[model samples]
Target: MPSRWIATFDEPALVAQALTALADLGVPGTRLVSPAPYRAVHLTGQPGPWRAMGWLVLGGGLCGLATAIALEVGTSLAHPMHVGGQPVIAWVQFGVIMFEMTMLGAGLTNFLAMIVLGAWSRRQVAKAARDGLRSDRLTLAIPTSGRSPEQLQAIRAALVGATGIEEAP
Candidate 1:
């Protein structure tokens, strides 16, 4: 089983240093718990939800456009309505429906994505709170399981100047 070690740091710089040292040691899945956002310890190269949400919204709009096209064309073809020598399926008249449907689809998709992302972030925050997160200090949770004694010692040495260090129960 993997054991977790929690290290509390009074300063963001110390937390940042510890994170860099852990990365140098090739430690994976290290989590930083902080009450407020810290630019020093921000991890890069992670994909955010906005990209996925944009793709989803685009897909929804396309589906809406397809639906509008089918509705207008299918209905016109089913009951051919030729008014004032105009075409049975007029693209100009269908523009309003297509635009409205596309906007509606994109808006609804964006709204749902926001809800899901908000809930997911809330769950993560709750979990962090359970893991010794505090409002006045920063915490780093390092997994020491499957590590050799030398590696464990190196991890401890890296975090030597932290405010406090202990194993998670």
Candidate 2:
């Protein structure tokens, strides 16, 4: 009773057509699996989560930069270092440290968000789809969680019309 179904098509163009037809029916979570990279067969209808992640990365970088500046300034003030009457907060000397910390914060935040938010677990590769994907076939996976029997029939009809091989539920 898995809540997913797949339809394999022979041509990439057919896959695109099927995707459009399914989208018209208001299908939400659809995926395309192909033997090679094909630009024509995009299936996901949801707005991607990358934009939010980019904001998070930017925040992390800013926090890291602030932390780096504070550390340098605080240490210099705690232990008076008057090297040739240089300012306590030497931006030039600490620029590399700030850059390094910024990168570290962004990297760590990206990794943690991917793991915790389940962004890394987006796609599930079935064995059948994997085999076909390595060959010369394209598969469209549609989530059938709350569809009616009539909707299912329409989906099957669309797949058959697109010269798809079989429907697996």
Candidate 3:
């Protein structure tokens, strides 16, 4: 049920226009990949790291703090062994474990976050499609499992207004 058909354009302006039109038409899973970055065709309407990633980072930080506090409290209370002239609850030494745990939490958060977002998933060649556009050319892709005849015709017409149209099977 996964397939892609790229709609090509010669200018970035046309790419953006068609993208906006298609999006307004309620097309889902649309993408635009071009040699040059086109600001207008961006569909996600979100910039920078996703909100979910921010939540992951915040949660990881809190978990790291909690672990560090638990370790420091439990260790100090159970076995109070003084080192040099410092008290048994010496924060200087405890800072090492805190730092290490914080780093570990952050690393694990990033790894898990990537996995959750399917960032590392392999691209199936069968579902991949492309439209040849020049470096100066702008393009868009509408990923669909089943496109209606009317929808396909509309997409073709919208793209044709810019440069040319090509659909992949």
Candidate topping TM-score: 2
Query: Which portions of model 2 miss their true places by more than 4 Å?
Result: 33-42, 115-137, 145-150, 160-169
Question: How are the candidates ranked when ordered by TM-score, highest leading?
Answer: 2, 1, 3
Error of 1 at 124 (Å): 9.0
Q: lDDT tens string, model 1, 1-169? A: 4477878888887888888888888887677777787964475223446568888899888888888999999999999988999899899989999999998888888889888975775453325324676787888778788889899999998885688877763
Regions more than 4 Å wrong, model 3: 1-4, 9-13, 34-41, 44-49, 70-79, 91-100, 120-126, 130-139, 143-151, 160-164
Candidates 1 and 3 compared: the better one by TM-score is 1
Best by lDDT: 1
Q: Which ten residues in a row have the lowest lDDT in candidate 2?
A: 118-127
Question: Can you give the lDDT of residue 25 in candidate 1?
Answer: 81
> What TM-score would each prediction reach against the true structure?
0.61, 0.68, 0.60
Clashing pairs in 2: none
Candidate rank order under lDDT: 1, 2, 3
**How many clashes in each candidate?**
0, 0, 0
> What is candidate 2's TM-score against the reference?
0.68
Error of 2 at 59 (Å): 1.4
How well does candidate 2 match the true structure, expressed as C-alpha RMSD?
3.9
RMSD of each: 4.5, 3.9, 5.0
For model 1 the local lDDT of residue 43 reads 53
